[model samples]
Target: MTSDIFAEWLKRQGHLVFKTKSSYWYSQAARTFQAFPYHRVIEPDNNEINEFLKEHNGVALRYSTPLSAKYGKISYHVLFTQSTYSIEGLPKKARHDVRNGFKKAGVEPISFERLAVEGWELRLDTLIRQGRVRAETQSAWVKQCRSAQDLPGFETWGALVEGKLVAALIAFSGDDCCSILYQQSATDYLRFGINNVLTLAFTNEVLKRSDVSQIFYGLHSLDAPDSVDEYKFRMRYTASPVRQRVVFNPRLSPLFNPLTYSALNAVHKLLPGNPTFAKAEGMLRFSLQGKKPLAEQDWPLGLLEQKESILKQY
Candidate 1:
């Protein structure tokens, strides 16, 4: 797959993205650059990172490096290895959910246009459930999905109950990696097990491809609760190990040290509710913690289990 398609998709969403020797870095949260594809562990030379920062007016650049590489916080890629994926292989409780979901909803590939028009409600429900309604607006969500329309390598899948969309996800098929992005399901349908059915069916479908070898659930989230990805783990995705690096502009590096992170974390805890504040605190915390050796850093929960499955393959 042409990786540029993902970058193009992001650009169409009105975000600025730049390319370096190692990967495509996109502007996020009004001032930060985040590397995409989620699975790429890059080795960017310091000079290049410095040059990019200089050119971008010193916006922070965040990317992942191998655990053995220098400077980053301990985090996981949260992935599923491509193998014989089946509901029969899922844990007992999850297997039950998938079975029930299949009985209740129809899983199928839908056009991005349909997602743009009908996905708004599911998106809203999801954000509301997560108390992240401020993270995205309905118009923005529709525009984002609509922009991916007809984009190659981007696929839309949904679990429909009585022909109404209850759960949906947008999967980008990168060469050797299928990244699942923007997954949301209606809260009421949790009983119907729509998320289980959609995740299982979509994941199985992607793994069937001979070229794709892994499915990325997402990065260890910077702000959301761990339980968000815990669901994916329940559905059989491994929290694959990686070091998420936050490369700050030299001029601003002083503001991101341990003391600053500690103070920010304390303030955010008391403030609560605002996503910008929460993420700002999380990012600073990651930047500070990542500078230490892995032995000294606190690892994200479950990051080691089945991690070798990806370290060996990717």
Candidate 2:
């Protein structure tokens, strides 16, 4: 895909993506690996990302691994906001109080049409100020937009405050489903409950359309140390699994697996404070831990037998 096309597509969708000078075509030409490489997936800089995609069809994407039923898996948290008006056990009074709190805090619903491109830019600036989007992720996202502009169907929604961008959500709408792709909110705005407000607003928007049946909250990681579970539940979104796979291409040699594992351990030990690693590792461990024999209290998602399949192949 041409970088120019991707850039225009994302801009049209109201994403705050900044393109690089180099194209994906040029980066692919420089690759030495034969179908596979031993390097771990690292967050590449804006320049590095654009350069890398230059080789891989000039598109950027993310994927997870697939697992067998015997090994166990988690379910992808698929919540039907239309039917999910209430959470399983959360008190109705608590939901009302939360909505009241949001209104009191100046949280308001905003249509996607009302959220202009400038609002997205402003929101991104707020994120940078709060140190949410690192330089690498930011760059990769821009390139990704450039690559996906030609995609058949895409949708987006967002909310603003005082003429400034506060919260936004982007997704792809299919025949009967909506898959959330990304979400962002200014750190300061999050304190004002814009995240929750935007979520409810967006869900309301989708629910209004008879064609849309369910909202895929994407993947949830029990591994998240950040604990956004309660918040997602508050929005009436259920917890589901997304499977992650790690593979060593046979052509790369037999030692690749052992070497990769060792390197990962070494890197984790070297940078225990890295937020990205924590988020990634948290998801992996959450699934693995669920399969082992443990006391009821020790298991977070209750037990594997108590619920439907949570493991999902993304």
Top TM-score prediction, candidate number? 1
Best by lDDT: 1
lDDT of every model, 2 decimals: 0.84, 0.45
lDDT of 2 by residue, 1-314 (tens): 33344335544544433433321112111121111110111222345443444533332222232233222233344355455453223457445544643563443434444444334554465446534433234444555444444465455555555656566666666546666756766666555666666676667667777777878764544233224445665566764433332221223325434345456556655766554554434433433443443332133442243333322321
Summing lDDT over every window of 10 consecutive residues in candidate 1, give the lowest-scoring window: 305-314
TM-score of each: 0.93, 0.56
How far residue 185's Cα lies from its native spot in candidate 1, in Å, is: 0.3
Runs of candidate 2 with Cα error greater than 4 angstroms are 1-68, 71-75, 81-139, 142-152, 221-226, 241-243, 256-263, 272-314
lDDT tens readout by residue for model 1, 1-314:
36789889989998888888888888888478888766888989899999999998755888888877878887888788857788878899999999989899999999898999889889888888776777788888888888898798888999999989999999888778888888998889999889999998888788678989888889887888777888898998887678888888898887778788778888888877677888888788788888786667766776755454544553
lDDT of 2 at 222: 29
User: Number of clashes in every candidate structure?
Assistant: 2, 17
